[model samples]
Target: MKAAVVSNAGPDWEIREVPTPTPGPGEVLVRVRACGLCHNDVLVGQKRFPFLGPGPIITGHEAAGEVVGLGADVRNRRIGDRVGVPWMQGSCGQCAYCATDTSLTGQTAMGCASPRTTGVTVQGGHAEYVVASASGTVLLPDGLSYEVAAPVLCAGYTAWSALTDAAPGPNERVAVVGLGGVGHMAVQYASACGLETLVVTGNPEKAGTARELGAANVVTSGTELAEIGGADVIIAVTPSASQASEALQGLRRGGHFVVSGIFPDGSLDLGPRSTFWARRQRISGSTHAGPARLAEALDLVASGRVTPMFELFSKDRIEEAVTELTRGTSRFRAVITY
Candidate 1:
């Protein structure tokens, strides 16, 4: 199998030939059709994420493909069935946090409790073939293309998760910080929910993009959003912790501030702890959605209520895609077609 592997901590991402492994019990081998290139891939390649390596690691979480083989006891999914591999590759199903009632509370502990994330702790989908647990694989609707479904597996799903956690009403004003993949989806979802969508981005050039994505208004910074009207909910979708923290001031008191983006060090500078308590606001974080929420997100996409725009790249041009992501030049999500 041809795969993209990261060799070291610097680190190096190179295309190499490797033997494809057959599926073990309760697993399925998917012939990867498309994989979304996220900044998380860069973090994994740099060894900044949870990867503990002997050497190279295949890194890509947002995968959409057709199943080619299945292992023992995998009766629900058959050969040629389309599926998507999300970020939460696997989790301890028996844990209290993973229980149905507890998983949607936007708690970080739920993710920290015995979680196995794709492209982070395990070999992921930056290859011609990937083996995923059959139980964790999501079935894609027939009408959804692999390229279109790829970003929904992570970027769009995370936006759906964070916005659902905030639970904003139709009359509320919602602000999406950063007009990238996740932020754009957040804007669309918020607008679909009939909430007034406000967008905050450091790049002034993205104002047009934000507006196109259904944002009611666009601002260059968080303070500008506050000057207009405080947001009932502020979802930060930038990798910069400082930028996310600054957006907290734009939220109305008793509002929710959800961190949907991954930071470099996992450290956020939220200024004074006392001020956070004084506001009586709810601060939460959401990872990729659970199974049910993932289904809802996919349904929203399939229904044409939420759409993703992307720049398609072939697997052979993976380096160019990674470079464009690192340079923050990709206007649309980059999906690598196999």
Candidate 2:
């Protein structure tokens, strides 16, 4: 099998032939069709993020493929079944967090007792073949294409889970900060949920695109969002912790603020004006979505209510795709097709 292998934590990826992986007990071997390149993968390649597995790793988590082989004890999936393997590969079903909330607890249980992560702690989907746990694989809808479903496994699912956690009611104002892949998806989801959507981006150029994605209003960073009209829920998808804190001011009293982006470094600065004395704002962090939310996100995509704008790339162009992702030059998500 041919795969894009990273020898170390640096900005380099090499295409090489590797042995095709076999499924273990309760696992399924998927013949890769498409993989979505995420910004966290770039951070892992650059040695900025923590890598739990060995070197010469295959890094790609958002992947959609067909099941080619099923291992012993795997009963839920069979060969030729289409599935998506996401960042939350599988989690320990026995952990306290998983015991309490099975919906959005995989990210917290990662690297713990019995959780495994794709493209980080395991051989990921940036190859022609990869093995995944049958229980963790997201079953693709009938009409969703592999390329379209790939990015939804990560970005779309994350956005959906964050919105679910916030639990915004109909006609409530939802503000989305940062107009990246996740932010754009949030806009579409918020609109589809019957909430009035607002986009707050530093880039004025993204105003038109944000509006097109279903944002009823677009405002700059310095705008007094709370003064004019506060939002019932504010989703901070930006990578900067400070920016996430700044988004708190946009939230109305008793509003929920969800932080879904992975920041490189630096602590969150929620000053007195942001979440102090009189401000009654609730802040929470979110990562990749769990199985239930992933299914919901896929259903939304299948219904054509939400869709991702992506640039397609082949295996040979993996490096170029990573470059475009890091440089923030891609129009939206970058997908690697087989």
Q: What is the C-alpha lDDT of each candidate?
A: 0.83, 0.84
Model 2: per-residue lDDT, tens digit, 1-338?
Answer: 99988886456998999888889999999998999998888887787766687658788889899999999999999899999998876766677766765543446545346567888878889999989988878899997999999989888988998899888988789999888878888899989888999988888899999999999988875246776697888888887777776767677877888888787886567776443446666888777656888899999999999998889999999999988888788877999987
The worst-scoring run of ten residues by lDDT in candidate 1 lies at 101-110
lDDT of 1 by residue, 2-115 (tens): 998877646666788988969888899999999998888888787666684334798888999999999999987899999998876566666766665434322422444666
How far residue 332's Cα lies from its native spot in candidate 1, in Å, is: 3.3
Best by lDDT: 2
- Candidate 2 off by > 4 Å: 93-104, 272-277
TM-score versus the correct structure, for each prediction: 0.92, 0.94
